[model samples]
Target: MADIGGKRVAILATNGFEQSELEVPRDKLREAGAEVHVISLESGEIKGWDLKDWGRTVPVDRVLSDVSADDYDALVLPGGQINPDILRAEPAAIDFIKAFWADKKVIGAICHAPWLLVEAGIIEGRKVTSYHSIKTDVVNAGGKWEDSEVVTDQGLVTSRKPDDLPAFCAKVVEEIGEGRHERRAA
Candidate 1:
């Protein structure tokens, strides 16, 4: 496990995020010694979507307007049908993602979270994976879609679903430890 002590990681999410996807990674990163922040569109807490119904709410560490991409070493996007859909439509969210890509900072998107990457226009020619239903969206956006538990292209880490959370979280830590990548800037 990478002991990324003092490293700052931001988890970009809003209401409707998959419960396990966000919580697990956030916890794992924190345990690995990274300072993790839950950033959202609003200042208040956001509710999460469990397997079926709404789950617990996660308090927001900071709002989108208050955060700068350069403050964090890695950006994590947790997926749920509603979560990514809302984020993809938000210009601020897309801009942050683009900033991370431009800096070659670590970016992890699991499940439907890859939608944000597609909207940011950074996944062109990048290999990625997501929830099975969004495979077409990834492909159409110029990403080489793969069916796997986890896929890491450059500093980008993606996974298929909640079942793949273990692998996804590990890859996020590994990428964070490696620091910025030398991938082509967006």
Candidate 2:
């Protein structure tokens, strides 16, 4: 396993997030020794969408307007059709994603979560993978889109769907442990 001890991972999402997309990776990352914080657009708790219906409610650690990119080692965007759709429309959320990239921190976006990356204008020239339906959007945004279960380019790691969770979580833990950009590249 990767040595992600003491690293801090910020998961940015909101209500209606895909339940497995958020919970599975979050649990795995935490178990790997990363301190995970869930930041959302609103206060209180954000509801999750399970496979076919509503599921658990995860508490928000802080509002997007209040968090800083420098405070964490990585950023995670857990996707559901509605979650990233709403977040992409929020300037604050878009800015948060931009800041994480500007800082060169590890960024993980699964499924439709790449919508946030497109909204942030950071997808240009990058190679990424996302849910099959959003590949067009990713390509249109200038990203070299792929159909792989997980794709890591530069410092970002993206996955195609919930079924890719195991590989997705493992890569996140690996990247967070890398800590430095040069080490991450090699």
lDDT of every predicted structure (CA atoms)? 0.94, 0.89
What does candidate 1's lDDT look like per residue over 1-186, in tens digits? 789999999999999999999999999999999999999999989999998999999999999999989999999999999999999999999999999988889999999999999999998899899999999999999999999999999999999999999989989999999999998543
TM-score of 2: 0.95
Top candidate, metric TM-score: 1
lDDT measured at residue 126 in model 1 versus the true structure, 0 to 100: 95
TM match of model 1 to true structure:
0.98
TM-score for all models, in order of appearance:
0.98, 0.95
Stretches of model 1 off by over 4 angstroms after superposition: none
Tell me each candidate's RMSD, in Å, in order: 1.1, 2.3
Off by over 4 Å in 2: 182-186
Candidate 2 weakest lDDT stretch, 10 residues: 177-186
| Deviation of model 2 at 8, angstroms | 0.7
What clash pairs does model 1 have?
none
